[model samples]
Structure formats: C-alpha cells, structure tokens
Target: MSLDFAKLPKAVASRLAKLGIRQPFDLVLHLPLRYEDETHLYTIADAPMGVPVMVEGTVEHADITFRPRRQLVARISDGSSELFVRLLHFYPNQQQQLAEGKRVRLLGEIRRGFFGEEMVHPKVRSVGSETPLAEALTPIYPTVNGLAQPPLRKLVNQALNHCVLDDTLPEVLRHDLGLMPFDAAVRLLHQPTPDTAQRALSERTHAAWLRLKFDELLAQQLSMRLAYRRRREQTAPSLRATGLLAQQLLASLPFGLTGAQTKVLAEIRHDLASTHPMQRLLQGDVGAGKTIVAALAALDAIEAGHQAALMAPTEILAEQHYKKLSQWLAPLGIEVVWLAGSLKPAAKAAAIARVESGEAWLAVGTHALFQESVSFARLGLAIVDEQHRFGVHQRLALRGKGGSPHQLMMSATPIPRTLAMSFYADLDVSVIDELPPGRTPIKTRLVNDARREEMVEQVRKVCSEGRQVYWVCPLIEESEALELQTAIDTHVALSESLPEYRVGLVHGRLKPAEKAEVMAAFARNEVQVLVATTVIEVGVDVPNATLMVIEHAERMGLAQLHQLRGRVGRGALESSCILLYSAPLGEVAKQRLKVIFETTDGFLIAREDLRIRGPGEFLGARQSGVPMLRFADLERDTVLLEQARDVAGTLLDHHPAVVEAHLDRWLSGREELLKA
Candidate 1:
C-alpha cells in the first residue's frame, strides 16, 4: 500500500519519495551501504588506526583555535589513555557537548597525529551516567542532504517490525537454487551480527548480496521479456520487401555494399515484412555507412506503397541526410520533403502539406518530425538517426504518428555486447561491422597542450598539402569556470596565425543558414580550416580534410572523441588526429585517452568505455522512465544475469502468481516503465 504523504512532514515526505520509498515496504527493502561496528568499544590508545572504531571517554579539555586554520579541538581521556578530537566544521551545541568532565562516545576512523592518536569530525554523543553498547552492527544508509541518520533509522526499524516480509518466490524454487528469501536478504543487509565479516559485506560476495542481485536481475529481465511479448500483440503494417526500389538505389550507388552491410540489410528486410512493428537498433562506428543502409530500407517502405520519415538529432546531420538522400532519390523521381525547426513559416507549412498529402514519399528533419503539426500520409517507416540523443518518449511519439509505424533507430555510437543484452533487451539490434573500401584508418596521437605550437605547425603542414583541416574546441563561448579555448576565439586565432588560408566557424548558436554556409565552404575546400564545436561531430564529411586537432580532449567523452576523429579518414589519403590534453588530467580522462590512442576498434573502445564509466553514459536517452538495476553490475554479475534471463521465462510460463508478486515487490509503482 502507498504511504500517506499528507501524514508526513512536507520535507520528510519529499525526501523519502526521492529515495523511491512511497510505501512502508520500500523502507523495509532499502538496504544499508555499510555497517559500523558499534557493538564493541576501544580505549583511545588501543583503538586501531585506519579503520573505524567506537570509543568512550570523559572530556579533559575543549577549545576553538586556529594555528593554521580555524577549528574546534578537544582532548578526551578514558582514565588511562587520552586522544585528540578535531572538528574542522562544528556547531556551537557540539562544542558545548564536548565540555570538560562530560562522558561521551565517539565513532570514526582513528589516525596517528603529531601529538597523539586523533579523529577528525567523529560522530559524538553525550552519555548519561551509563549507557549500553549497541546490540548489532549499525547500518549507514544512502541518504540525501537534510535527512539525518537518526530519524531514517527509526523509520526503517519500524518498517522492519510492521511490514509484511513474505517471500516472493516459492519455497521449492528457493531451495533448489540455494538462494535466500527476499525478506531474509534485506534484513541481514540492514542489521548484520557483529560476528559477520566486514570483508564479505564490503566486497558483496556474501550470499545475501548474491540473492539480492539475482532478484534484481530477474525482475528486470522479466519486465523486458513481458514487454517484448506484449509488443508482439500489437498490430503493425507488414510492408512487403519486393527489393524493387532497393535494388535500383543499390545499382546507382558509386560503391558496393560491405559484407556486414549486406547481412544487416537482409535482417532489416525480414523485420519489415513482419506483422508486428519493428523496434530495431542499427548501430555502427561513425564511418561504417549506416545512412546508406537506412536509405535502402526507406525504399522498401516506399516500394510497398507507404511513405517514410528519417529523423536526426541535429539540423546539421538532418540536412546532410536530406541532401544525400535527395541526391540519390531524385534520379528515381522520389519527392523528399525537408522539415526543420529553422524553416520559415511558409516553407515549413509547405513541407508539412506535401508530407501529409502523400506528395512526398520521404521526409527528413530533426526532432521537428515529432511535432504535432507534422502529419504523415502513411508513415510505414520512421528511421531515427542518433538514437541516443532522443529519449524513449520522443521515439515512441514519432512511431505512434501513423499507428505504430515500423522503426529503425540508428546510432553512430556502438553499444557494447553486455549492455545491448541487458539494457537493450527489448529491441532487435543490427550491427554494421565493416568500413567500406577506400576508407583509410586514422592514426591517432595524444599530445600535451604544452606542445600547442607544434600542433599549429602541423595544421599548417596539412593545409599546405592542399588538404583541409578541422580544429575542434570543446566550448563554444568563454566561461569563467573552465577557461578552455572556445570555438570563437580559436577561429580568430587560427585565421590570424594562418593568414594564407581561410578559416570558417560553426556552432550550435549560429543560425542554420550561417552554419550551412560555413560547412559548404569547408566541404568545397574553399575554406582550408573549419573551427567548430561538437556540432560537427557527425555528418560533416569532408573527404578532403586530412587532419583534425581537438583541444582539451580530456574534457570530452570516449564516444564524442571517437565521432570527432571519424570526420577525417573518409578519403583514400592517409589521415591523422591529434588530441591535445591539459595537464593534471583526471584518472578517468587518462583512461579514455589511453584507450582511444591504443585502438581504432569502436567495439573495443565501447567495451572499455563501459568498464570505465558504467552503463549510464552508453544507455543515453533510453534510460528515461526506465527502471534501472540498482544491485546488479552488468559486467560483474554475468552469471546472475544469465540465470535471471533463464528463470524469467520459466516463471512467466509456469508461475503466474509468483511473477506478479516479484514484480510488485521489485517494480511496484514503476510498472509502466516496462511497457515503455
């Protein structure tokens, strides 16, 4: 049952809800982060160093002083041994509580200081004449600001007492798998006995942790499998793949398809001819030629007497697809309508009308296609480019435009295998692993910013060879916080330093017309250098551009850096990308640089990215309104994931009541996320 929010104080209720505790049972299930061994006490001198311990003593002295900095200092003695306690930050009441001759208990890490053993800002509690030590290891939970441990601990204790602790799974299954019941796992996690090993709890190799991880994974897998089953029940148009127009487009292409592309195209054709809607993810490295495959798939929808819409994340990429597809489709007399937010009112209206009245068989634009004003005559296919940029709702909204149109979502960022299996389990995925012929591999180099002058000379050398260069800056404008080089400033500096060649600039803040003009000049080699932000990260393909210099490469992510590097090496000529990084680089940034410099394989880079940064960055907009796993690590708990995936099917097939109970205990209020 849902907790009565009105009965709680406004702030308390808000904080509890933020922690996903809308019901009393939620508090019962909210496990501890770590346990403090408050069950035993230590003398000040005998307390272990570098680990937390509980100690009781009488205050000998207390004062606020500033030798180097202002702080509160106190000396406490347990009759035989005395230790110093310092608080860098403290309240007046806390100073009073540490007054001389008062008995107190402290819990914190102890370390050897200049004078003696010391604890910095330890948890302090004034003792009456006598108080009993804690009976069990104290649990320290995950909490937000303004919520203290005392009240939260009280609520959780009450929940443990009053909330029902029934097992969601049957006794037979629990015994067969050797898994602990859900209630026992939650309880043990919250209140472990003092004898419990800290190493087992900290490392989460305990049986209780395993059970929780298995249950979490099982719930997630069940939700995805059920969603998959329900989706198949919905009806969608079965567009027959006659391969008439697809063959025509393939013949007109200047280059033939790679083996990977041919294989993926066949998969798309099979899905398109299905009665249910196709929710497929087509991903490849930046230069893997996904646009051409999607273009041919659009032709299949058209050949089946239905229209198609291609949507992108940015106007630059959208316009690039529009121009390229229009160029290819124009020979066959296919009308392609261009619609974007930047279009003039009359132009936008005309484009929408043509699409609505079936005058155009293809429509390409940014997110404007998801707008209410844009209606399709018969949107058999809705191909979204940069699927990571659009949220789950936006993609669903676009697909719902023409009564569940078949979707082919495309991404330049490849998804790691484990991530695709767990996070993207609901969707069908197609991968293009091969780069087309004549595409040369880019040599990547990591350079320190101290060598900026050498890079300037390097840029001039590439330009002198009659090839273009791209200078990428992390920021578009000046900011007091980061103080990194901005695109605007870099554009001016490059133009002045290399006066023999023209340098053009483009950024998100620029008008569409102005940005297009600069890109056009750079594409034609009229402008020898293009200075821009990540807006040029994708779809600005200048085969003549042989060099790319990225400033503050440490500030960008692995996917963004890889995409930026892909702009070059599109031509037969050898290309190189130099990543200029600032010193004092963070550990994560260093790992990203090392991975990118070591390997040109996108899949390997994606795997490394997943390891360095968990699944959040890679999941992208698809994480919206989704119930993410809290206990299971996709990489570390592969055994649990495999077992859960297997059990989810069996439970749904034979144990419907158990399935409902498991989902209720785990998902509860967020069941709709599964359907999404």
Candidate 2:
C-alpha cells in the first residue's frame, strides 16, 4: 500500500522528506517507544479502597450539591463493590445525564474521605456491553501537535497490516541470531502477549538498530577506504625539503621546540615526501606547541616552491596566527599574508592579488580564503584549526581551490581512542600526548559560593603579584528574566570589589574590534582581571595569566572546564583554577565538579562526560546531525551498536557491490553520498 504523500500538510511533507521518511514502510518502522494500559479493569478486592486503579461500574445515585460552587456527586458500583466519584463542575446542570443507572469507566487514585472511600475528579468514559472488558496493552507513541495518538496509531496499524517487508539480512545473520522472518517479527512487536512482547520487542528493535548501525559503519569504512585509495592513486609531487630556511627559522625562535613538536614536524616531512596526500589530524591540549608544528609544515611547503594556507575559525584567531607566523617566517624572507572579513576592500583585494600571484608564500585567514575572488597560486597545503567548528564540506571547498592540497586538521580537545575511532575514523590521527618542559600544571580547586569573600581576597592577592586573572562568567549578558548571574553583572561586581585594579570584559555579542580591544588590554596587563564568557575558551594564549575563576562551574561540561583550565598554566608561574558553584548541587553537577577536581586529563574528562550524559547528549543534539532513535539508547545500546558495526562490516566485506545496490536503498540516500 502506497501513502498519498499529497494528503499530508505541505510543511509536514517537507519535513518528512528532509528526514528521509518518504514511504509508508519508513513511517511504520518508527514504532512506539512505550505503552500505558488504560483498560485494566479491577474490582474492590483487586484494588483496595485506598489504592489507585481503573474500574468499570454503573452509576447508582447522582445529585448536584453547592459548596459555594456547583459540583456533581455520584455513587457508582461495579458488580463487586460500591464507590463514590466526584466531579468538580461549575455548571452541574451540564452533567445531569450522568445520573442513576448510567454505566461508565473511571480512572483515578482511590482515597478515603469522611464517607468510606472515593475517587476524586476521576477521568470518566461511557461504556456499553459491546466494549472490550479486557485490553491487554495500549501503546503510547512519540507524537507532535496536529498528529495525535489515535490517528497515528491507526495509520501505523494499517501500514503494519499491509506493507511488505524486505529481509535484506543474509542467511548467516538469521542462523547466527536465531531470528524470525522480518514480517513475523513486526507482527509480534505490534501484538503479543506480555511475556512474548518483551522478547519480540527486543528482537525487532535489535535487528533494526543493528541494520542501521551496520549501514553507518560501512559508509564510514568505505569513505576511509576510498580516501586511502585516492591518496595512493596520486603520484608524489616532486617537492624537496630544504632545511636552510626551516633551520634558520628554528634558530631564530625565542624558545626551543619540544620533542613532541619535533616528532610531529618529522611526521609532516615524511608525509610531504610520500606519494599520497596527507590527511592527518593533529590532536593536542591547550598550550601545546601545535602552531609551531604547523609553521614548520608551511616552511617545508614554501621550500618546495608551493604556498600554504592556515584557516582559523575566527578573525581573532586568524590575526593572531598571522602575527605569530609572520614574526617567525618573515625573518626567513618568506612572504605571509593575512586575510579576514574585517579588512578594507582595497587591502583585501591587494592581499588576494598577492596570494594569486604567489608573491605571498603563506596565507592565514578565516573562511574568507574560500571566497571566489580569492585564489591561491600553487597552493600545496591547507591547515584547518579547530576542525569541529567547520564541516567537511567547508574543508572540501577550500581544498577544491587548491591542487588537492595536503590537508591537516588540528584540534585542542584530546578525545579518547574509542571515541576518535567512532567520530574520526576517516582521518589519520596524530596525537601530541606530552606537554612542553617549561609548562606548569594548573592546580584546580572546587569551592562553593559561600566562599565568595575568601575567593575575592585570593583574587586580590594574585593580582597584587602582577599576575593577570581570568574571571569567566557563565552567561554573555545580564537578562532580567533569568536567575543566573551574567558576565556583565559579574564584571561590575568584581570591578567594584577590586577598585584598585583595572577590569576588562569580552563576550560574543561584542563587535569583533571591541572584543579584540579588550583582549589586547588584558594581554598587555593594562587590565589585571578579565571577565568574559567561554568565547575565550580557544586559542587565546596569554602566558602571564596565572589564575582562572569559573563561576557556576557546575553547570559547565567537563570538556569546557578542561579548556578553560588550559587557558592558564601557560607561563612558568604556578597557576590555579577556582571552580565556584552554588551549594546544593544535583548528582550530575556534583560528579562533574568532583571529576574536574580529581583529574586534569582531557581524555579522562571526555570519558566521564560520555558516561554521565551518554554519547548523544555529550555530542549535543544539534551536533549529531543524525536522526534520533526512539528505540535505541547510545549508552545502554553499546552491545547492539558493536553487533551492528560487525554485521555492517561483514556484509560490506563479502559483497562490496551490494553497497551500490539494495544497501543504498536500505540507507534511504546516505549511501550514495558516502560513496561520493
């Protein structure tokens, strides 16, 4: 049976299309998550006087009474027991028909009153001899406005009754799992005895989840496999590493590079010498010398008679990169250009022309690099920092502008290996697990808001020592409606508390130039304390900042806390992070604070975050970009996910061609894009 797609509201139809719910089978498979039994009939013995229950009875006596307001009082009796039911009504005359000798079913909590026992304001419904006396179960479906339970339930039942199921699972799966046919399983799931229902529900849901997981993993593996294949197909560009400029730039550096940095540089050098284009992820914690490694790669590219580009997610970061890269590369006579949206048209045009003509050997900018007007001459390498903020399409857009540039994505978050495999299996991973020698560990402490006075004194002492401090507020601005403290309000409070020192503020709502000005003031030590939101969570390095204060710290995620802590400990001075949260924290919030206090390891924090919030919420609802599963819990469904992954892998390994056939159809449309 085909669904008349035209009957659905246009908006709903458009949404359905977006979600790939185009066919009747697609809608049917979205099964109910849980159920409630509203038709469970009971007698007085089954449900005692004071126990809540659902009962069918006939009305024996009904009357209207006025207790300052009109109300309906009735006496009802089933064949076994008698009870009183009350209906609070302003217009008692409207319920005149609900008098003696009326049959009805009632649902409510039974409670004792001045009389014997009664059900107050129970949900009542009319019933006749034709009504079923016993309903085994009633399904409660996931729903939205305009699509209520009855219609949705009816449509689903119709679909299940008529739609034919395709059992794409190979014989091996059926034999190994002892599974029933797909159609039979669907029937059992919709209608089964209580005992068999549990087993049927598990089997049907597990099969579907496994099937979907297999599709996802296979797509991932295929993408990675294709990337590897493409790299092998391309011949190595004849590029030689001339160490004169690289050595010169290194010697001119104010500080020596760490062993980890040197090792990463060598890895990049090796990739440059290989026949395949490098697709690598550079993972490091904050204050780790990733930028130095990236700069060395640029040096190698420049020495090889090609240009490189470093794309930051924001103009502030881009400008910071340009300044630092220029200081090191400019001295070696390597031309570097900075491009950002904030630049004047004339300056931007001149910079673009310089990059187009290869007059600039290295360019650093935000997404402005991919504008049609901007072109790179002999671009050989592209480095994207904070890769998560940019999607694959954006990265590909930049690569398309160059000649299949060697791509290196850098991230400050240190994810665990298991998560990395699941999230970034398509990319070759390189992790810098060691910190530099001069870097100091940040001492972390958890304190309640009651210690505000002590904390203020501590802040004064830290600032008196000529060290800068970061007082991170929870919100961007003050809102009259919200009860939470805002950065602006905290900034005012802190400024007044420490009137002797200058305080600066930075937040997302501030104009780009204004934010830069405040940050510059803090960096220059003109302001001893900077109060800002998490906008300063990434890539803003100030070595002299020795203290970090996070307000409402319990509300922040572990990863964010780790990032905020990373902002400090840059300098050789002993640094500390003060987590000030209100008292009476919830279980999860308390656990979060405890974890932050117990360990500074980003990977550990990530694992704890996953354990507490589950993978879906940890990644965030918007970030998943995948359909939410009603039957599957990413946390509790790990075993099923692993099974799904294995099944998907086996299918692809045996029949790679199936990926282009029924597998694509099974996946709706994602399979086609995955192949591409």
Candidate 3:
C-alpha cells in the first residue's frame, strides 16, 4: 500500500499542511498526545475525579434553564447514584438526544459542580444498553482548528499502515543501547496495550517514547556534527596568540581578571590560533566581565596582523562596547572605529574608509557592521554580543563579511545545561560561571502595584543615601508610541512625587546625544532617578545605582528580569530589585515572577524558563536557523541526548550508510544554515 497526501481530500490535505505534514512520513511521525480510556465503563460513584473516564447511564431528565445564565442541564442515573451534566451552550437536538430514559456514553472528567456532581461539556452520544465497550483506548492526536480528531486519526492510521518505516539504527546498536526497534516503537506508541502506564506515555518517559526521542536527538546531533566537520574542512587564518597586545592590555586594567574569565580567554585564544575559523559561544552571567574577554580576543587578532569586528543587537549596547573597547585598546596604539545607523554621514564615511584601509584594527557597531557598504580589509575575527537577539541570517552575513573569520558569539543570557548540550552541540562553548569579588547579590522582591507609592518612597530613600535608582515601565503591546508614553508618564510621575531629586527620562525614542547625556548624568550621580524602557536591559552600568523598580515584572521573561536586576547590583551598597506587578497574573507570568524572586542563578532561571516556555520561544531567533527538536523535551531527555551524541559520532565514523538514511528520514529539508 502507498499513501498520497496530495490525492486526499483538499480540506484534510490543507489541515495536514498547516501542521507541516506534507507526506506519509510526516503523518507517521505525528504521534498521539494522550489516550482516552473507553475499554471499560465506570459507574457514577466509581468514576475517578478530575480524570477522563467512560461512564454510561440513563438520562433521568433534560431541560434548558436559567440558573443564572441559559444552559442545558441533565441528570444521569446508574441505578444507584446520579451525576449532573451541564452545557452552557447547546443545540436543541442535543437536548432531545439526552431526553428522559435515554442511555448514553459520557467521556470526560468528573468533579463536584455548582449544583451537584457533574461533567461539563463532555463527549455525549446516545447508545443502546447492549452496546459493547471499546476493545482499546482511543488515540487523541494533536490538531489545529477546523480539523476534527476523527479525521486526523483516520489519516494517521492510513499513514501508519502504508508508510515504510525502516530502522535507521542497526539492530546490534539498538540492543547495545537498550532501545526498541523503530517500527515497534512507532506501533506501540500509536496503539499501546491497556496495561501500559499512562503516566509514562503522557510524560514521554516510556520505552517507546525513548526510541522516538533518541532518534530525533540523534538526527540533530548528526546534522550539527556535519556542520562542524564542514567548517573544519574549510581554511582560515591561524591568528597565533603571541600575547604581545593581549598581555599589555591585561596589565593596563585597574582590576584583575577573574579565574573564569582567564580560563575562557585561554580557550578562545587556543581556538583563534587554530587553522579553522573558531565558532564558539561565550556565555557568562550578567556583569561577569565578558567585555574585557572580548577585548582580549580582539587584541589577539590585531597582534597577529588581522582586523576584527564586533556586532551588537542595539545601538546603545554597540556604543557601550565601542567606548569600553576604545578605552582599553587606544592606549595600546591600536585604533578602533565605530559604525552605526545613528552616525553622521561624514563620521560613518570616515569609519568605513578606516575599516576599508585596515587603519582601524577593530570595528564595533550594531547590525550596521554587516551592511553591504561597510567592508573589512582583513577581517580575521567577528564577535557578536547578545547573539540570541539577532536572527541566524544576520550572524551568517557578518561571518560572510570576513574571509572565514573566527567567530565568537557572546550571550549574557545563560544557556541551560540541556540547551548547551543539544542546541549548541556543534560549537565549543565556554562559560564564565563566577562573579568578581566585592559585588553584593541583589535582593529580589515582588511587590504589588498598590505599593507603588511605598516603592517611590523607597527610591527616594535610596537616592537620598547618595545612590541612584532605575524605575522601568512595562513593555507595551501594540504601540511603541504607547510604550514611550508610559515611560514619559512614569518620568513625570516620579519627578513630581520626588521634587527634591533630579529625575531624567531616556527611551528608544530619545536622540542618542540626549540618551547619552541622561546616562552620563546618572553615572555622575547628578540624575538621582532614571526612568526608562527595556533599552537599558542590556548595557547600562551605574555602580552608584543600588535600587531597581520594574513595573509589571510579570510581563517580562526570566532573562529580561535577570538582566534588569543585574543593572542594580553592580555596586557594593547592598542593592535590591523590586518587581512591581499588577493583579490577575497568568500561569506563565506567575512562574516568571516566582523564578525571578526566588533565585539569582541565571542557569537555574534558564532551566525554569525552558520548562515554563518550550525550546522554540526559548531559542528566540535561532529557531528559524536551526532544526529544533519537536518531540524531545530537553530537560527530561538528557540521558537520551547523551546516548545519541555518542552514537552520532559512531555512526558518522563506522556506519556511514546508516547516517545517510537516518539524516534523510529525519532532517531532510530542515537542515539550518547554522554557519555561526
């Protein structure tokens, strides 16, 4: 038998297409979400509470009533006890179907209701007393709107019976790894025995699920390994780290490098000295001194007579890097050039000319660094800060500007262990885990909006003690205009309330000069209170600022909250961050607030964030550029990931035939252009 999705009904084909299922293989991989138990019937009293179960009883009566709102209410009796059925919205025929003396089957959760024991909006149908129960549990698959479950199940069944599912992993290998055969795993997952543990299946921890996840992870690892091998095959300049420039700058700094920073810099230096372009991800928690490490990396490239460039996601962050790097490198007689969208034409022209002439040893800017007009004379290294905020193509474009420059991607947002293992498997990752000494941990507090006045008073008190404060407004949904308005309103409110202190406003709408002025004043302690938007979430540093009051903290993610909190604790005056949230928080918002309030560990917060939000949203722009895992849960399938990673290397080396077939089946067209 053969399955042709294109020849199927247009509606069915269109719905399947909506789910990225274009072929028989896709349908086969589209597995069940959960199973509905219909093989056994439970009486009203015997049916478990808060779980789906099959129940059959005779309808004693059915009527439409207005207990407060109009609804169809019915009572079902199993000869001993009764259960109420409420349908807030129902058709007239549904009432007739459930009229008195009718025997019907109900499949839904049972719980105590407003009136009595009830199952609201359950699957309802009339049935004869002699009707037999199902022989197996019904498989409920994931579907989109306008596609019903019955049709989806029929499509999956067709695909399963007709689609050819060959085992990609060798039988000997599967046995060695304690994995089930591919066909058996698929069949068991689609049609499990009644004795199978529901919890294991639901949580994807069953043996059958293990095979699927392992295969998926193995495909991803194989793809990444191929990418890594391809990069190694290409040639790049070996920027030997003579340390002539790097050492001189390190000694010039007033502060000493942390041990973690030293270790990461050594790893990067080793990579830069290699023949192949270094594709490494540098992850450090906020304020871990990544800038200095990046500076040193750039210095190595310059010392080896190769130019380097650094790209940031925002102008503010780019300027911050330009200033810091200039302060460090200018004294060493290595000139630095700044290129940005905000630069005047003559200034931008001069920067471009310097970069083109190789007079500027290192260039720093926002996305403008990758613009076609900006050219690099001998680009050897490219560093991207806040790498996640930019899409995969943007990073690729930057890398393309150089003749295969050694790329260093930096992120202050800590990547969780599972993510680093799975998504970033191809790159050599270096982490700066420890902070420098004398920095006090920021105390995180969750306060309600009603206490806004008290927080105002707290800000007043903190500033009166000769420290500064940052009061941030929530991100607006539709309107940048509205977001700017909110910032302006907050700035006005703070200034009026605290008349004795100098309050300054800065937002994305502000001119660069104005924004820089406000920031410099705050750093100088002239502006006691700074009100701004999330623009400051990345690059602002004020040691004197000891208090941070974020409005509507529930509206932000764990990473943003962590970054915002980091802005305050840079000083040693016992900093604190107050997260002010409004009422009626959603489940995700509550979780974000709780995670931010309880722990300051970025890695722990990242793990919780991944759990709260899945990998697609968590990976941000990388989702479009990488083949993401759809079936595997990173947090739960770490062991399988480890096994697959080992197997990927094995298959690539010994079973090359098996590698082609496996990659063809899983990642055929989904391979990302993940150059960086």
Candidate 4:
C-alpha cells in the first residue's frame, strides 16, 4: 500500500514535509544523526555532574523570575533531593505542564547552578499514570524549527514497526559481501540494544554503517553503469581522425606535444573512430595543455566534414578559446566563429548562419551555443571546458544538438580517484599527467600582513623589469559583514603605493564589456599590475604577468589557490606566487599554504583538497544530475565503491533481473539522472 502524508496530523505533516519526509518509505530511510543514552533515570542528587543524564522528579514550585532577565524557574524534588529546571523560552502549555505536584522527566547535561545542580533548557515531558518511558538509547534526528525530537522519533519508530522492506541484494552476493540484511541493518541503525557499544554506534564504527554504505555505493554504481550502457546503445557519427587538420595544427605549434598529451589524444582518436558515441572526461592540471588536446580533437571532427562546438562556462573563457583556436585553425583554412550572449545582433546572426550552413567548421561560445535558435549543420564533436561548472542536463542538451555527437569534457580541476570512480563512472576518463616542456615552476611562499612592505617592493621590482603582476583580493568591495580585503580597496592602495605603474581593477560585478576591456588591457601590458579577484583565475593568460600576490589567500580553497597560482609561470621566466595571509593562521589555513608551497602537482593538491574538504564541498551538491551521495563517504569508502562497481558489472552480466530490483529499491525516482 502506498503511504500518504495527508494521514499525518496537519502541523506534523507540514514540519515533516519541510524535512523531505513525505512517505513512509522516506521515514524508513530517515536515519538518526546521533543517539543519546537516556536509558537509566536517577535522582537529581545522584545524577552525574557535567554529563548528559536523565532525571525524574515532581514539580514542587514553578514560576517566572526576572532577576537577570525573563526566565522560568521550576524547582523539582524526587522526595530525597531537589533540582532546578531553567527555561529561557517556554510556552504556556509547558508552564501548565510543569505545575506543582506534576511528575516530569528531564534529559540534559547536569551543571552546578547558583542554587545547586540544574539543567538549562532541558528536554521535559509531563509523566502520567499510563505513560511508559523508553529504556533504550534515544535516537536524535535532524528536526525542523517547529518540530521537536519526541514526535519525530516516534514517527520513525512507527514507520519502522509497519515497514516490510524486501532484501534487494542477491542472496549469494550478500553472503559473499558479508553484509547485514536490509531490515536488520535499518533496525540496528535506529535502535541498538542497551548492551550495544554506545561509542561504536554513535561514531558509525559498527558494522551497520558499512552495510548501508555498500548498499548506497552499489546502487550508485549500477545506475552509472546502466547510464553508460544506454548512451553507447545510441548511435553516433563515426568521425575518422585523419590527422589532416590535427597534424596541420600541430605542425604550426611552436612546441611538441608531451607524452601524456600524445597518449590521451590517441585514446580520444580511438573513441572517435568507433561507431558508438564517445563520452570521455579529459582531466588535466592547470597549464597541462588540456585546451590543445581539445582543439586537436575538435579538428578531427571538422576535417571529417562535420561542425564542432566548444562551450565554456564564462564569456571570457569562451573568448580565450576562440582567440587561441582561431589563431591555430584560421591559418590552416578553417572558419572559426565566436558566439556569446553579449554579441551584437548582427554578429550573432552571422555566426548562427555560418554554423547552420556548415560554413564555419568550428564554433566556440558560452551557454549561448546551446540555445534553441542555434542549430548545427553536422556537428561531430562537442567539447565542454570546466565540465564541473556545467550540469549534466546542459551536457545532454549540447550533445542533443548533434544527435549524440562525441562529447569530450575537459576540466582543469583534477578530480581524485575516489570521486572519479563514483561520480564520473559513466564517462571514460583520461588524465594528462604531464606539463609541457619549458613551463617554469611557480615558487609559492606565504607572507604575513606584517611583511606587506617587503611584498610591495617585490611587486614593484617585477613590474620594473618589464613584467606584470597580479594582486588578487578576496572580495570585490568593502563590506561590513566580512573582514576580507576587497579589490576596490586593494587597487586604490596598490596604485598609490606604486605610482609609476598602471593598476587596473576587475571583479565579477563589472559589466562584461568593461571586464573584457580591462582583461584585454592587462593582456596587452597596458596595465603593469592588475588588481582583481578570482575573475582572472581561469581565462587570462598573460606571459608577461610573472608575479602574483594573493591577499588573504587563506580564504580560498586549495583548488582555487592552485588555479590562481597557475596564472603565472606560463612564460619562460621564473615566476613567484606570494600568499599574503592575516595574522594567527588557523591549522587548516596553515596546512593549505604548506601544501601549495610544497608541491605543484595538481593531482596531489586535488587529493589533499578532497581530504581536507569532503566530497560535498569539493564537488558541489549539484555537480551532476545524479543525486548527491548521502550515506557513502567518498574519501573513506573507496574500497566499497570498487567492490560495488565489480558487483554491478557481475549483476548486469549474469543477474539482470536482480539489477533492476536493486535499482528500483534504491533509485526508483532517479532513473532519469542515469539517462541524463
């Protein structure tokens, strides 16, 4: 029978709905955040001090007091000892419930009050002759503002009592995996026996967490694998990599491709030559020549008499790709068109026409490229840069433009192996593990605010040597809310401190045209020192800008700091990155700075980033169409992920019916994400 939220009380249902609990199954899966041991009740005098304890007593006196502030005080006695109950905020119902001679149960940490031992804002419930108390550890769930723990816990217990969940995993597989049964795992997770180790259950060290984590991991893997199978079933144009355009573009380049780049390009070539659609994720560190590899891949599609589109998240990045690709392909007799949201009507229309008429073999633009008005004549490949910034639906939309054209996604933010296995399981991944030759390594150092004069002198000297500098501020403008330095204030300070050099400012708040103008001036060396935010992190590639001073660098993440540092060291000159931090650096901030100063490897930094800031913060909540993982910790449960992948493959090969059952049980409503 289907469960209904309407059957619940009106107020209770509203609060539960806010917590995303609409059905009984939702309640069944609503696990407790923690467990409080409220099994043993003691008199107020016998309760353990400074420890969470349960006490039972009868109210002797209750009234409102105003010595320090508005307060409600209730003196309760257990016939042998007296205790005080303090309530800062109380309802009239609670006041009546705590009237004289009324028995009550209280749970909170015991502390020595001014009068004696007491509990401030303790959880209270009026006891009656028929009321039965729970004798086990009480489960504490995440609750809404208007909801309390008692009702929520009772609802979950009620759901559990009526739930008849079937075991989803195959019998043999479950036995081999040594996993607990589905119902048993849920029951134990919610209500362990009094003898169960409180520490183990509360810290998720018990075997139950492993079983649930495996279950969740297996479901995710099966979904992604099924999605991969479905995508391959869809036919796509098999564009041969003839190397006509790719070879020409390579020959025009000043340097040779690194071995890693060559290997990844060969893989892409193999994928393109196949009849099946190519869904590959190309991961490269900053300055590892990912764009060049993408450009080469696009050229193969163009040479095969098909159009190719490269989409970026921002217009600046789109324009950067446009300029670079145009320079490489225009000389080889290939038409390159740029389409952006800010383009003039005439220019956009012409660009659209060229794309539709197959006059332009290569098109580079932002999200505007995927608009309904724009259509490709015969698109063979679609390249998306900074793939994480774009959603899975956006990728599907872009690929739909060409009837499932070969999709190649490039990301400068290198994903750790755990994330790659779980999140990018659907797509084939290729890592460019090598940087091009002659790319200088950036020297990273941390400087405190007291060394401001020394850092300023360093910037002035770098600018005097005919090179530029980047002074990055964390915030755009001065705000009373945050103490971080702002670009506006920094620009003014830098311009005044170094009057001989040109200082230009750029931030996200600037108009596109204005921002583009400032970036262009910086690129042209008109601005010797560009004071900006992270707007220049991904796109701006100025060889003359060799020095970068990031103020309040500790405020940024490891991945972002690495990207900003990558802005320098593109040229042959030795580059330096000074991280100006505030005084009294925190442990995490100090570790971040040390990691950047120690190693320049993007993959190492990415792994460290994942370790420091879990998967949720590292990969955003809406990274893809797939639902955010709630049970499995990607950092700790990678072994489970690997096992799940193997089990999923086996099930698909040998036990297809069970696979469907597993997916239906765990991911019934999320089937569309796999297809996406």
Note each model's CA RMSD in angstroms.
1.8, 4.2, 3.6, 2.0
- Model 2 scores what on Cα lDDT? 0.74
- Clashing pairs for predicted structure model 1, backbone only: none
lDDT (CA) per prediction: 0.88, 0.74, 0.88, 0.87
| TM-score, model 4 to reference | 0.96
Task: Tell me the RMSD of model 4 versus the true structure.
Answer: 2.0
Among all windows of ten consecutive residues in candidate 2, which has the lowest summed lDDT?
667-676
The parts of candidate 3 lying over 4 Å away from their true place are 8-14, 42-50, 55-67, 73-85, 92-104, 110-118, 126-133, 344-350, 438-450, 476-486, 509-514, 571-574, 581-600, 611-614, 621-624
Model 3's alpha-carbon lDDT is 0.88
Sequence-dependent TM-score of model 3: 0.89
* lDDT digits (tens) for residues 383-405 of candidate 2: 99987676455677787778677
Given candidate 2, what's the lDDT at residue 80? 86
Clashes counted in candidate 2 amount to 0
Model 2 alpha-carbon drift over 4 Å, by segment: 7-20, 38-40, 48-54, 59-76, 82-126, 133-136, 161-164, 177-192, 197-245, 254-259, 262-277, 620-635, 642-647, 661-666, 671-676
Candidate 4 minimal-lDDT segment of 10 residues: 1-10
Error of 1 at 270 (Å): 0.8
